[model samples]
Target: MSNESGHTEKLGIDDCTVPETSVSVYEALYRRRMAWDFRNQPVPRDALDRMLATAVWAPNHRLTEPWRFFIIEKGSAASEKVAGLAYDFALQRSGGEQRAAATRDSLLKTPVLIYAYSTPGRDEEGTKENYASVCCAAHNMALAGVAEGLAVTWETGGPTRHPDLAEALGAEADWTLTTMLSVGYPAENPRSERTPVANFVRWLD
Candidate 1:
């Protein structure tokens, strides 16, 4: 049976000798959520690799393959540097030292932060295609994370688009910051409801 998160309950070897392939894809799709709270445990390299691999498979017109991913693991020097950037960015805003410190601490506690960007295309149409392709790639990665039993959130806000963050990521001035994914084990199970298919879909024959 499935749980609230739509994940199948684990089975012993006697219960199932092989991986459950029949419903895995749909299960991942249903299980995916925008996770805000997360454990500080680092995601395994193999799992991360699988997520990226799926991302590359997303269709791109002209096969520009403009997506770029930058992974920052917890407790690493790079993580600290990024956290510092968050702190500085927050401090420069209306919030003072306290809020800045909290922002820094929150980022420090995240297990992994993956920043996604799209390289500038040659023309306006190409740029639009690249943007759409990168968005698809990010969604692909998010679904893969669900399959890995990891919590993931895609965020795009002032903090994500901050010039300081762009500089920290070594992003080119023209490159577009797509979104940032915060990934880790779930500290809490969060449930979300979606609009019924009938509510959003229209059929014409």
Candidate 2:
């Protein structure tokens, strides 16, 4: 199949088989939620890899796939080191030992932490495109995780803004920290509210 962009692709007949489920794409869209409370159970490595594989397929202008992910496995030395840095960063930012400790504990308990970074393009417009593409990739990962029966949340707060954290993640000078995704099994289903599309969308006929 080919679209207006003239990109041709072929799919195997076997690949067209859909799983027997009532969940449609729209259902998946509505069902996916940001999860806060997570279980200590680990997400399988193959499942995580599947999520990432789906993530990289997100549309990008000029095929500039600038997204890069750093996976910090739970209970690993790298995870501990990253958690320590995060704790220090949180303490410095909030000036609360208790809060920092809580944050550290959460990081330690989470099964996977995927740090996303984007390498800037040649010009300002190109850089913006790269950033947007990275956001789409993150969204892809989140939705894919949801489909795999995992809880997922994207965080772009302290770590994304911290220079030390970026350095620790080995991001280059031109690369920008985009997001950090926490993926694991849910401890509980947290309800979320979203404003209707009518509130933000405008129809032009």
Tens-digit lDDT track of model 1 for 159-179: 574577878878887889898
lDDT of 2 by residue, 13-117 (tens): 455443344556676678788777888888999788778876667888998879989998899987888888889888999999999898888888889999998
What's the TM for model 2?
0.87
Give lDDT per model, in order.
0.82, 0.82
lDDT, model 1: 0.82
- Residue 8 CA error for candidate 1 (Å)? 39
The clash count of every prediction, one per candidate, is 0, 0
Candidate 2's error at 204, in angstroms? 2.6
